[model samples]
Target: MSSIHSVTPTFDEQVPFAAIKERIVQAMCAASLGAVLLFGAGFASMETLHNAAHDSRHSAGFPCH
Candidate 1:
């Protein structure tokens, strides 16, 4: 009895070269956009917190003046 051997490359070979390249580019763009949005939100929230703290300490009735 003789067995046949498969010569296919697997995963990367399953898809065409152009398609794989397009997917990689799309994923990179999505990651960059996500990073920008996350950092932007964090910075905005930090500034708001700082302003609130400063205002509370400067209230007219406080003895720390």
Candidate 2:
């Protein structure tokens, strides 16, 4: 019979599941932040638009129109 080789475990090997979960959470959070920033850069606040539209009571209710 031939001898088999065995590998040693490092500190990270003790809890592989926890490490994987942490990585997943970190990636998701980073992606979410990126999306929010992108949207913010291109997004116009509806509240501001609404107030502007309503501020002019004599502009047919559509100032931007």
Q: Pick the candidate with the highest lDDT.
A: 1
What is the C-alpha local distance difference test score of each model? 0.80, 0.76
TM-score of each: 0.46, 0.45
- Give the clash total for candidate 2: 0
- Tell me the lDDT of candidate 2: 0.76
Estimate the Cα RMSD of every predicted model relative to the unseen true structure. 11.8, 13.6
**Candidate 2 local lDDT, 1-65, one digit each (tens):** 99988987677646679898999999999999999977865586888656755777546664453
TM-score, candidate number 2: 0.45
lDDT of 1 by residue, 1-65 (tens): 99999898667646789998999999999999999987866777777867765688788555443
**Looking at model 1, which ten-residue stretch has the lowest summed lDDT?**
56-65
**RMSD (CA, angstroms), candidate 1:** 11.8
